[model samples]
Target: MLPSTYRDLLRTPGAAAFFLTAAVGRVGIAMTSLGIVWLVHGRTGSYALAGLVAGGFAVAEAVAGPQLGRLIDRYGQGRVLPPVLAAHAASVLALLVLVAEGRPGWLMAAAGAAAGASIPQLGALSAARWSALLRDGRAAELPSGFALESLANGLAYLAGPVLVSAVGAGGRPEVGSVLAAGLVVGGGLALAAQRRTAPPPAVTGPRTARSKASAAVGPRAGRSLVRPGFVVLAGLNLAIGVFFGAMQVSVAAFAVEHGVPGAAAPLYAASSCGGLLTGWLYGLRRWRAAPRVQLVVGTAALALGCVPLLVAGSLPGMGVSVALTGMAVPPILVVATVLTEATVHRHVLTQAFTWLNSASAAGSAVAAAASGQAVDAFGAHGGIAIAAAATTAMAALAAAGSRTFGPPAAKRGGGFGSSAPKRGGNFGRSGGV
Candidate 1:
């Protein structure tokens, strides 16, 4: 059964609508890269070209995400989302047409880039809205809300590829691409329409020192990327991404080595299932540990969990190991989100979250290349080793810079890591879970 916390969250007026829309949009976003690969590979019969196209798309999105996020933060979601989504839809259609007509690979890649550049950072935007809605009084609910977003992300990735595969089974990969495009456009528009839920445009009036500093730095200066806390979080997320990318490739290679290539899907699904279950559980309880403490613990657990992959000789062993590793994933993300919301100025919160996403995407790209090389040279074990090392790096970073992740002194009382009296609820109190 769904927990009461989540139930209460959904009961918040306008929450259910935006959450559902964001989920749909996120699923579409997940499908896009795979959909591009399928479509291009089907049309060109060249895995290399398909990979190139998909890589271009990923790079484009990573590059453009923070900038788009800045615009959203500055102008507000209702004003910014519509035009961006429209561009995304148009670019997707262009990519589909290019694939159908057997256009040059570079041209197809360009279309994909256009599509990627316009993709909305819905997860980050949604988190920003939650911050706006709950920060004043219901701040304790923030972790649960972040956990729910992370769960949505995990589910999207888990289901997106399967849906793409199923939809493209008829050999018309373009159909899946079309479906992905439709969901993104439709969901984004619906989310935009929920104006009441969207965070207001950042007020840049010269009322405070921060605002004055932002003004001094020029219009684009208050970007979350410039902050040290954001940098720390981005590095941690990048390491997490390395773990993800390496795991994906290594698990497949392991399945192939065991002469059960099809087992890869189930093995990977085990990890996702584990993450989903634990993410829900993590959200249900109030924790005594600070967000920084939770982050360090989560990263350490993730590193240790990957250790089993090195020794797992059988498919089932690998599944168990990956599942354990996955259990640590969501809590880390939830903690990161909490810390980000606490540390970043609310005006730039959306940009901060999107920058984290961009960091993870960049890390995934780097890890994919490195893991592919390792797998080719040292087999699946090499990739698994890389995964473990990445998580270990994440743990090291978290421990070394734990102080940097602390919320501002003022926010500590009612939010994460506070010992003060609870104003809204017991969600952030230091105690049992």
Candidate 2:
């Protein structure tokens, strides 16, 4: 009933095309952020300036994310993505040139902002494709589909750094920016070409010209902002991001204090590996718990898992603790995506997703800055304690607003229900247990 491996997902028509396309975009996402930081720091010789440029890039993305998503929702991926990718690539190239030529800081910031504003929302769009393609009667397949996407995202983070290191060898940081731009152009185009998976444009009533244009704009007119459920989801994602950011710095500080700074990457990779394994197994299950309950329980457990990090003095102990904590991360993300899918309207899914992403990004940025200061003042233990506290707060919020996550599909009477009238034709009947 569920895909055992990603290969099973690949066998589904159009799934392979879209997944591979998403992988390309994910790789670009993973490389570009790190690449920009390295390039700016190397050229400017000031960590402050580097941080400022990187912050500008992220801030621009946070500001423009939902607006770009709304455009994609209104115009279709094919029409919207190509121009955006072109602009994004152009902006990156401009940044690359400015850094290479040692241009002033303001110009660099402007270029970084442009790059962020034009960057495509590949993850959100990919998830939306899966939701649209697997809807109607194949609802049971949705979990496996989302799990595969999550796994791909994890793999991207792992592989993207390797690509950046290879390209930026011998301190050639500019090379990574070029490579990242290439990935964006090639991947974005390929993803946009999968028109079969693209969500259909919003339906419009035949009437006044103004009404037609408004309908075309649809979610762009700010419908998603008015929803309380979506706002809560955004806050939840932000908390998760803060937890992740603090944990990351804490782990790095731990490695450095123990005189094996290089071990930090391996320790982080161990956690990602745990997440990847759990995500695969999770997709194969037919769960009894509602998604909202799962979210609350999972977040609480994750918070508790972080407790070990504070006491894990040895490197191996810290690695073990990190891996255990990471096992909870993928499921939380998968559950969040599922809830967003269920709660938001179809027309505004991209916008809703972008809002969640923006919130998370902002939280991570704040945590990274704050945790660094804490680590400097009070050591790695302080950072770990802070991370645990943030996770605890996240758990509390999840517990209080579990209802916003929405009821599970099985319990909602519309999905794989025991008494749902057999509809959706061949796909529906074939998927029936």
Candidate 3:
């Protein structure tokens, strides 16, 4: 039976509102990539141009993500989120208008990049809220929270493209972007209203030995951006992104080769379904292995699962392989989220998560370019080889970092939930939101 942990978490003040809003926003963001690609292809009739513009959007987002997260860390979410989201909505509208009006490709790419850069770091923000709320003895509940995030992400990928296609049905692709903008605006406002769960900012001042030492060594309250532990964790997520990107290209290529291009969606859906089911089961039980061990083991399992892809000849065979391979994905993500929370101070927690997000985006961008070349030269086999190689690299890195994952060296009393935030900061006084 699935545990009622999610229900219990939802029962907490503001959790339900925040999560629902986050989900709506996430689904909208998911739609943008496919929508952009389709819109560009429709306008230009060149797959190369469409792919290039889409790549530019992803690259811009990856570059801007950390900087935005830093702003959110320094200022509070309520202060920082609304303006960025507004800009994002405007950018989306601009891109849709330009595409519909047959504007130059450069102009379209520019607008798309703006929209991508301004996408609210909703996943990272939600995790940080849950981290703040679950501090102290309730820390064990974090795995369940992270699992919920994984489920949301899986669902978004599964459903978002469908929504985009439906909106674009019968020659109306621009409607998709309009709908996405509305969802982003609505969700951002709703989440920003929930100031009660916002984490306090970390102390920033002239560097001291204690601060420097804590940053170098393990201390939960240490400045996390400087820590090697967080760097390694981010690297692991980057590798996971490479595997994901390569697998996607490989699946699309395989489906095309089999003369069933439409089968790509079902094949990808199989993987998402597998991840979603495992996420539910994973959250039902408390974890035992150290996060480091789990990261290594989960990565290794993913690589092993992909081995079947080498022999998969038909769509059904590939679908089964993809599903089995995807089962290992959510656990790695959940462990990575837990590790990020453990290494970073609560104040900068959102920034740390955004760094991971950036790393993943970078990895995906690199993989997409490389996999495209490989698929053209050596077909789907080459793409699967890339996926396997990336996962193997991730496993190796995780194993090397195993000894580094543990409780912080210096003990900080109480939890972040117990810390009193400074007065006159952004977001004003906490309310029932």
TM-score of each: 0.91, 0.89, 0.88
Q: Quote model 3's TM-score.
A: 0.88
Instruction: Give one digit per residue, the lDDT tens place, for model 1 in 341-379.
Output: 766655566777888888888777888889999999999
> How many Å off is the CA of 220 in candidate 3?
13
Top candidate on TM-score is 1
Greater-TM-score candidate between 2 and 3:
2
User: Cα lDDT of model 2 overall?
Assistant: 0.77
lDDT of 2 by residue, 103-145 (tens): 9999998999999898877888888787777776665566667
Candidates arranged by TM-score, highest first: 1, 2, 3
What candidate 2 gets wrong by more than 4 Å, as runs, is 1-5, 203-221, 407-433
Decide which is better by lDDT, 2 or 3: 2
Q: Give the alpha-carbon lDDT of every model.
A: 0.81, 0.77, 0.76
TM-score of 2: 0.89
